[model samples]
Target: MSTITLSSAARARATGRHFVPRLSWLWSGLFGCLVILNIAPLIWGILTSFKGQADLFRFPPAFVSFTPTLENYERVFLSGFGGNLGISLVNALAAVVLALVLGLPAAYAFDRFNFPLRRLLFLAVVASIPLSIGAAALLIPNYVYFASLGLTNTPIVLPMLYAAHQLPMAIWVIKGTIEGIPRELDEAATADGCTTFQILRYVILPLVRPALGAAAILVFVGSWNEFVASSVMVDSPSLRTVQPAIYSFIGFFGREWGPLTASATLAILPILIIFALFGRLMVSGLTKGSVKG
Candidate 1:
């Protein structure tokens, strides 16, 4: 009886080990499929960008073995997509820099100082979430106001609006990061005869650098992808940003699918590159700031 029981236990243990490997493989394959599904559209767009106009409307869509051409890419350059991209870059960069400069000091002040209406002020700052405004809602007001200012078709308007929109979120993230710093460090710096500016420049800034990078990345991306504000506020060919420039491919006659896709591919490249470079810092900063010690 004892020998029979021992044999049964050994069989059960062996079965469990085999089952675990099977389950893991099953789950891994399912997740892989999900990732592929999510990425398929992007892959299709990229492939379509390389196809000639004739290939684009082919009866049976071919994922491969299509004749590739540079006609779309050439048209993109010839249409002055380069100038539109430069306007977008300038607007996004300027907005990010201005938001950071304005938000950082305000965040430090909120964390370190006690002042009148502090809670109310903090709440006000918290209310400014990025991307909160709907395009339809903003379109009329922005058009009317900027048109009145004689700035409707200028490059300056979008950057200014982008900075205003980003400021609240920037303040919120930076303030949270500043709060994570030890009060003892600020005291230590003071004891060492560090002035307020000096302490902030040397101590606080370095410690919160990751959060700054993370916040800046968020702001920059938001500003870059801004469409409604840029689209409705400015109609000048040279001053248009990437989104409008991409839309130009679609007209009354027909959609220029090849150049449309090609321009889109070019537009999103900057965002992907920025994330690849700063993704680790963004993740680290967000994680560290979420937990208060």
Candidate 2:
């Protein structure tokens, strides 16, 4: 019986060693697939931007173009595309700022206070998704309402919509982040004669930044890529954002492939760059939020 037990234990150890390598290989394959999935589009976009309108529609897609030109980049920078990009940047930045500002305070309140209906109120916030806004069905009335407020065809409206759209998620993200931080830090700061405002500003804000950055980046990308909301609400030529810019590229006459692709590249680049720079923080924010939820 002792010999049988020893043999069984040795067999188990061998099985465990075999399983570890298999798991490691599986994880490596998954990561490689994720990287390739993300990068392929970006590389394809670059190639398409270089390709002329005809080359883009070739019966069989070709990895190499016969002639690549700078027209796309030139049109993006020097042509009317520049203004659309500016508007997109403005909209995205404003929405992120608005979302963060409102999200932080609301999240703090929900996290700390347990007053009447606290959980109910928190649920209300979470339940209010964009679908509840009824934007598509309410376009006309919404326009009339906004016009009454004198917000029609303005950048303010985009940010306002984006802020509202992002608020629920942002609140949740910041709340989770703030909870992870020890309360002792706040108590210690207060004991050191820090005011409520000072304690929040110095201690809580710094600690919660990763979550906030993650929230901001998400909101910014949404706002930047926003199409229906921006197009429906914004009517003025100067006010139209990147989505409209892309639409304009494919007019009734013909699609401006090069310039359109170039603009697309530019539109996507900033968010990618942001992701690259703050990768660890984003991962932390995502993981923490998931675990908390």
Please give the clash total of every predicted structure, in order: 0, 0
Candidate 1's C-alpha runs over 4 A off are 1-30, 132-136
- Model 1 scores a C-alpha lDDT of 0.87
lDDT of each: 0.87, 0.80
lDDT of 1 by residue, 98-203 (tens): 9989988899999999999988998887865734333456668767887889987877888888888888878888888888888999999999999999988999
TM-score of 1: 0.87
TM-score of 2: 0.83
Error of 1 at 67 (Å): 1.5
**True-vs-predicted CA distance for residue 25, candidate 2, Å:** 2.9
What is the lDDT for 40 in model 2? 94
Query: TM-scores across all candidates?
Result: 0.87, 0.83
- lDDT score at residue 65, model 2, on the 0-100 scale: 44
The per-prediction CA RMSD against the true structure, in angstroms, equals 3.0, 3.4
Which stretches of model 2 miss by more than 4 angstroms? 1-16, 129-141, 187-195, 286-293
